[model samples]
Target: DPRSRDENGLAPIVWKREKMIPYVPTPIVYGGYLFDWSDEGIVNCVDLKTGKDVWVKRLSEGGKYSGSLLCIDGKIYGVEEGGTVTVIEAGPEFKELGTADLGDASYSTPAVANGRLYLRTFSRLKCLPAKKS
Candidate 1:
């Protein structure tokens, strides 16, 4: 009820989807798509307009993920709790570009700024500078 105050007066939900989307580590949106993954490393790409899945792919065998996914430069970067980074092409098709192990556990989402990527793990922070063109 929009007329009253408090929790009982909140606006009604416009729509709801039956599909399961990740609740932890927040999802990211890009190019008319919503990108999210489960803690077990099942990545889901959903079309924002029709609330349909574009593609779903398993990123890892059974690695628990704590950090959120990051999208940059036409790519999606997801880090597992074990510190392995999976890079996927951001598009309708599920294409894994590559993967790298950070050699530690990561609990924080990655950050990009000034042509560099910053990642934080349980023990330390790692920075990767952008390659020169």
Candidate 2:
């Protein structure tokens, strides 16, 4: 178990696992699970209570992934360095929902606010219309 001592000198319990390479995106906690994307672009869903990986999926064949991840409405979004945005259903099975071309080089993370998605490339910013259908 990965435990850390708090400022009060009390131990804070943390779930532990081995051979996990932390990725750029912060782990997403929802419904008793911690979702993380490895530096190698592998998505792992771990049991929050046990720190055991429930499922793992690779987004691409060793693609250089640098962007952050976005999960909303039971879906996980991943953006790769090659300007590809992949939307996958969040679950034990990796189900690809769809993908879109970003059209340029991008390192900036995608942003979702007020149901709208904002993305930026090197010198251009694109606003995607968001309406629940």
Candidate 3:
């Protein structure tokens, strides 16, 4: 199993000239690109068919990022363990859109329903306005 940790530790499988490993969270595919993030605040975008990295970027103020990634209307959102949500544009190049502070630590992935965003933090659950597209 991917999560099993015992005699065998984590290892990176070679992909082209780079070492690649499965992300802790399921990656999302959009516009022929795959987007995923790591707990170390590193985000990567790879070509959906070639398994080749298009771009890799790290969020500022590095910290634990446990929340699963969310993609909506061409933007990808990654939540840090400290409750800060970072939004980035989904494409070949990396472009950080913005970030929001939920005011509490969050490990659960944010959800969307009926045009609103829902987030569960350590201390609270919040519903915020999400742009309709």
Candidate 4:
């Protein structure tokens, strides 16, 4: 698998220079999975150790994915260009929990503080409280 290689082996697998990822958003690693967002608006979940693709899901409308991923309480978040935030369960299966829109444009990652999620768009900012179980 792609995850069990040496440091030098990571170069060719972890990142494919030949392909165009197109986005600069940071990726998150947790629970043995690496969550990444591509400029094509695709959310990719890969095995952290082997670099194998566990699953892939398109976040929203295609293009302009600049939000970093956030994982909290076994859930993950992906923000799309049009301010639509997608919440998903953190697992090997592609399960989207929900989606909420904030504005017309969102290029930054959502922030979590004091159990609240802070989202920003080209025109506004919103804070959503964490849902109680």
Candidate 5:
């Protein structure tokens, strides 16, 4: 069901899926593509023009992914519930950049602002400095 509504109470159906994970999936639009993450921590690249899935990759294991995926500097960031952050290249090819241990547990979505990445764990909030030259 579309959620957008204007004065006329109508919304355009941009895309629809037959089956989706039972978790919050945030779709990031970048470079003419839509990047989506499943609840089980699978990353998928879809063509924004046609909504066709171009590729998919499993990002993490052992725990479900509850945080929304973040795309920065041509890389995808997925944080699992067990506090593992997996970074991968943003494209059809699955290229891993790095993985960092946040040392905590969380299910909240992450946010990127002012070039810094913010993550909320079960006990505290962590601020990761933006990549520097």
Candidate 6:
């Protein structure tokens, strides 16, 4: 509800993804849902208004996480600390488009603007052309 805000003047956590312990990824909100994940790579999509999960899935082989999730157009992009980027469709059903290997540890989230992707690793920054639908 717009009428509610936390001490920092941000909206409260409308939905909490279950079993996301130790480390929680920064969630991306779009399409009336919030997408987040656990440090172990369990991704959850929940209703925007209610805290009900639409679906949940594990990505990658499971490891530590430092980067948050990103949403562009209608796809979700996530980077694991060990350095693989996972792309999935943002919708009621779960669908992974593809993944890109960073070849090293990455702690920053991918920046998406103007249909391009900017990914950063410990030593390099890469720019990828806009993905084709």
Find the candidate with the highest lDDT and give its number: 1
List the lowest-lDDT window of 10 residues for candidate 4: 11-20
Across residues 18-78, which tens digit of lDDT does each residue of candidate 5 receive?
6554367577777888788888877778887678888877764535887787888898787
Count of clashing residue pairs in every prediction: 0, 0, 0, 3, 0, 0
Lowest lDDT 10-residue stretch of candidate 6: 14-23
lDDT of 6 by residue, 69-127 (tens): 88887988888898998888999898878887899899888897777889999999998
C-alpha lDDT (0 to 100) for residue 24 of candidate 5: 78
**TM-score of every candidate relative to the true structure:** 0.83, 0.81, 0.81, 0.77, 0.80, 0.80
User: How many Å off is the CA of 50 in candidate 1?
Assistant: 0.4
Q: Could you give me the TM-score of model 5 versus the true structure?
A: 0.80
Residue pairs whose backbone atoms clash in candidate 2? none
Best by TM-score: 1
Candidate with better TM-score, 1 vs 4: 1
| lDDT of residue 90 for candidate 5 | 82
C-alpha lDDT of candidate 5 relative to the true structure: 0.78
Q: How close is candidate 4 to the true structure, as a TM-score?
A: 0.77
Quote the lDDT for 116 in model 4: 89
Superior by lDDT: candidate 4 or candidate 5: 5
Among all windows of ten consecutive residues in candidate 5, which has the lowest summed lDDT? 16-25
Worst 10 residues of 2 by lDDT: 59-68
The whole-model C-alpha lDDT of candidate 2 against the native structure comes to: 0.74
User: Which model is ahead, 3 or 5, in terms of TM-score?
Assistant: 3
Write candidate 2's Cα lDDT for 1-133 as tens digits: 3466779888876656667766566667767777787767788888887788888888754465677777778887767776777777777666778878888877767888987888777778888865466
TM-score of structure candidate 1: 0.83
